[model samples]
Target: MKAVLKRCLLGLATFSLVAAASGAGAADPFPQKPITLIVPWAAGGSTDILARVLSEHLTRSLGQPVIVDNKPGASGNIGSAMVARARPDGYTLLVGSMSTHAMNPALMPNMPFRGVEDFTPLGLLAYVTNTMVVNPSVPAHNVKELIAYARANPGKLAYASAGPGSTNHLSAVLFEKMAGVQMLHVPYKGGAPAVVDTVAGQTQLLFSAGTQTLPHVRANKLRLLAVTEAKRSPLLPNVPTVAETVPGYELSVWYGAFGPVGMPPALVTRLNLEINRIMSLPDVKEKMNAIGVETATSTPQQFAAILHRDADRYGKLIRDLGIKGE
Candidate 1:
């Protein structure tokens, strides 16, 4: 009887130890499975391409596949809302943009998600170069010339944008307000479509990302007027900045990564470090530069500050301009 009791006691102890070990293992490190990177824009656009490139590098770095899932609509609100509502686990992430994080909230009346509060900013990915381009048929060689012509023609000239609340839209609005000109505003469903229509001469002007417009410029389908950055782009040294002609006209779009709110701080730190490292790579910089994208990396705190600042800046601008979402 004493030997049987001893064996039972030992078995019970062994079971407890095994259970505790299992529990510890269950709380394993992040990215135990594939990660979903939500790109809140249509495929083949700048955001989608950037997300895909980063996802490829992230997969190699983290030892798990990082898939880019496009859920584009409502000027990036549909997909952004999905990310905002996703579980706080590191498995779900966002390839967010200024349009979704800053511009949309200010322009859209019924935003589905609270842009800043619903997500944890992991890091800033890049600052995309925006250029003002016109169809080859337009009689404008530079920014000053374009403004002169627009002023001469008034509402006869029309400009294309990604949508109502997009950076493209706001950039054009700012241009109008500063230049003291009024041209027709044509908003499309996405940047790709807007670029397509502008290339087809359905619209006369476009202020769009370099990745989307550079190829058209090179192909001679569109003519580059002025870049919207404060300074001339290294990729286009001869092309002057809009600020050169219109003193304070500067608008640049940026991209960043985000995780759902309540993500583990350690996980956020890990992602920010890895992404910054990836963005700093020589090969990565070369690739991004080729498409007219400047690699920009920032800490989580810095990124959050940028969001807050832009939100205030753009929100007031949107209200002041009476801009409404589509």
Candidate 2:
């Protein structure tokens, strides 16, 4: 009987040790594993560029590898949906944009997820200098000339877009309505291709972020017409704005970080602080600025507010514009 009692006590001690170890493991700090930073665009675009740079800094800040994976297609919905469906443990995150989180739902029929509901806003990342450029061969020197040419040639001025309902698409469509002109919209699968085709003169006009359009503009393959911001960009103050010719024509595009819904509030706060700090770093700012991206940051709540606001604003704009997803 004593031997039996001794064996039972020994088993109890072993069980206690295992239970304690299990509790310790559960209590281990977050990011016990590598995190995936999904960029819902092709590599070399502004989104991918920002994601890579951010992942590098985040890897150091979080003390774990932050991997950037490019998952481009369906106007950024494919990768965004993947992140939306990912486990909300903060292991997976998305480098999403105004279009993906704001405009896509209203634009795309049968959207897979709710932009605000399916994700937790982590932080606002940066704003790109969106520009209007045309093939050098197009006989337009500036926004006024482009509008005049489009009015004269209506539907003859072929414009390129990332896809239907993309920023570039909406930018051009709005330009047409406000300028009282007509242009052919040629939609491509992504921005890079649209820029390439526009440079090659397959399509003549393109309104895209400077990261994609500026290089070709410098190369003389395309002409810089005007910026799509309401105010002239500080980085390119000398450049005129589309609003200068087409009043109230604004297409300010911004990038942001997001995790799946149900992410811990603590985690969201921690990431927002770290990401804002990283964006404010001088070297990081300079790096992004070189690509015409202005690094901006915001609290998680502020970022969420922007998402909700843009979603509503763009929803109305898309509908009023008679935009339909293909």
Candidate 3:
């Protein structure tokens, strides 16, 4: 009996030691299972494409599949809400962008979730500029020409947007306000449709992301006028910036990754490191450049700070403009 009790005690001690070791190794062996990256946009969009690209690289590095799930709607709010409600475990992540984090919050008065509060920033993935494109039939070759024509036409000239409260929408709204024109505003379900309509001549103009608009422009379906970026895009260096004609007119779009609120710092750091590594890859940079997107990386803290700053800036702008969410 004494021998049996001693053996039981030894087994208990061994079990405790194993448990402690496992606990210590928890974060180190992170992502033991496949990770689900939720992109709050339709598949094939720039944000979705970026998520897929990063997922591929993360899969190779972590030896686990990184799946992408696109849940697009509500100006990217529905999918973002799903992420906001997801568990803070490292397994579920969000490919959040300025649309969902900054513009949506600014436009929606009764936003379902707070941009900065609802998520733990993993890292900033990329920053890309948008272009203000019009149909070739519009007779506007540049920003100054477009503004002059818009003024002459008043409400006759129309511009399409992905939706109300979307970055695309507010971009036009701000543009109309600042340029002192009366262009009619048309809203669509997504950026693709807006770009398509603009390309097909159903709409005269739209402010669209480089990825969505560049293909059509290159195909001669849409005309490229001015980029909304602060400077000229490497992809379209000849095209001028809107700021060139309208001083202080700069509206850019950016993409980032985040986890649900309260995500483990260890997991966040790991994700940031992997994503930054992928961004540094030449192939990855090349792919993004082809779509006219400039790749960038940032820490979780830095991303969170950006969200806060943009929220405040856009929120004030939206309020001042009386922009309503769709």
Better of 1 and 3 by TM-score: 3
The top-ranked prediction according to TM-score is 3
Off by over 4 Å in 3: 1-22, 25-28, 200-202
Over 4 Å off, model 2:
1-28, 137-139, 200-202
A best-first ranking of the candidates according to their lDDT comes to 2, 1, 3
Count of clashing pairs, candidate 1: 0
State, as a TM-score between 0 and 1, how close model 3 is to the true structure: 0.87
lDDT tens per residue, model 1, 263-308:
9888899999999999999988898887788888999999999999
- 1-326 per-residue lDDT for model 3 (tens digits): 99999999999999999999998886467777898999877897677878899999999999999999998877778888988998898888898888788777767778889887899988888887788999999998899999999988899898999877778887888788778889898899877788888888889999988877877887888888999878888777888999899888877788998889998777788889998999989999999887777888888888888888888877888888788877
Residue-level lDDT of model 2, residues 1-326, one tens digit each, is 99999999999999999999999998888779999999988898767888888999999989999999999888789999999999998899999999888898898889988888999999999999999998889888988888888888978899999778888998888888888988888899877899889888899999998988787878888899899987888778899999988887888899999999999888888889989999999998898899899999999999999899888887888999778776
**Candidate 2 — number of clashing residue pairs?**
0
lDDT, model 2, position 47: 73
Better of 1 and 3 by lDDT: 1
Candidates in order have lDDT scores of 0.89, 0.89, 0.86
Clashing pairs in 1: none
Error of 1 at 259 (Å): 0.5
